[model samples]
Target: MLSQITPCLWFDGQADEAAKFYTSLFKDGKVTRTQYYGEAGKEIHGQEPGSVLTVEFELNGQNFVAMNGGPLFKFNEAISFQIECEDQEELNHYWQKLSDGGDPAKQQCGWLGDKYGVSWQVVPKVLGGMLSDPDTAKSQRAFTALMGMKKIDIAALKTAYEG
Candidate 1:
């Protein structure tokens, strides 16, 4: 059974597009369903009848829902999806794909904002181990090196930790 809790992403009439884009990026991803705005919500939502209202999708086996919630609210950096990559190649792949057309200024410390304003962190799986090492100096070094990078580099972090 699918998990009861799922992240609901807000979009300004781009739920379907965003869902499709995300699904294409992951191996186990797929759009499960899509719903359209109907006549009942016309007075309040102002969305054209039959326009996309919501899209349910899976990315890396995690379920999510994207809704065309209008422009009243905007996506901020407070919420972000974190992809724990197994290696540098995996991390680079996700970083490149997710950051395409995204704001370059927002690219820092493995975090980026996609063109649609959704924030994401493409990180190496070893990042947690490096950042939480029992040795404080090693952990600090790894943390410092990570902060200086746009995309997390596992080799750079290992060098910093060893130094």
Candidate 2:
């Protein structure tokens, strides 16, 4: 059975590379299939015939597709995948891995842009609870603390929330 929805990532010419990177980073990740460009759409796609065109991959058992769609489009903060970590250790691990070779300037409030131009948010699972507290002061403090850091600091957020 085919999945009803699969996020397709567009890459300039690094579909294979990007797929491999993503799969290697997540548990149960793997390249399920590969597709090559053909002469049929040479005029429309302007891609090298017989070259790598698409890669079907899975991350943590979730299906995803990568297409060599040229540089017509790029990933931005408008659409980002959020990783809700259960603990500070998990958050640190993900943040370190995802931020490797990423743009430091774009890193803020738990948001980071990877080397592939993909934006990802590394968040703590307890963050929502703290930010949505009944007390506005507690929530605002948590938000203020969060806005000042690139990688989320659960301990800092906890301090701010408890204050």
Candidate 3:
């Protein structure tokens, strides 16, 4: 029942589907509600009476609400979910799933996208150490290694920082 902490997402007639897809991506998460507009509600965006208006779900212990907002807006790469992974295995799993349908963009550190146009970062915990390393050279190398990856190669990052 956490309030004031949920992400409200806008979808173009795909709120329900997006909710279902997001729930499937994370453990301990699922769609909790799908509310439809009724005849009493004014027709909006040509939505038929009784059409779904909102979808509520949870992912990775975070609550999300999606609305059929009539294509007024969309998700962009500007805002992203950052997953700090423990190791490369976890990073790969998340990278594969999230990038299944979206375009991949290589950035310094860890970042990518899913087919649904959602941005994500599968960062390794070790990255924090590297970025915070006392040695400026190692930190620069770590930054360079992060820049060369689309899906974060933890081993490469580690090697860069260590060497």
User: Highest lDDT: which candidate?
Assistant: 1
Q: Can you tell me which runs of candidate 1 are displaced by over 4 Å? A: 1-3
Q: Give the TM-score of candidate 1.
A: 0.96
lDDT of 2 at 62: 74
Candidate 1: give its CA RMSD in angstroms: 1.5
In terms of TM-score, the best-performing candidate is: 1
lDDT of 2 at 49: 89
Candidate 2, 1-163: lDDT as tens digits: 8546888999999999999988887777899999999899799999988999999998876788999999899888888888888999888887888889988987998999988989999899999999999999999999999989889889989999899
- Model 3: CA > 4 A from native: 1-3, 105-109
Q: Cα lDDT of all candidates, in order?
A: 0.93, 0.90, 0.79
- lDDT, ranked from best to worst: 1, 2, 3
Tens digits of per-residue lDDT, candidate 3, 18-64, equal 78887886777799888997776464467777878999998877778
Alpha-carbon TM-score of each model against the true structure: 0.96, 0.92, 0.88
- Worst lDDT window (10 residues) for model 2? 1-10
The TM-score obtained by model 2 is: 0.92
How displaced is residue 75 in candidate 3, in Å? Answer: 1.6
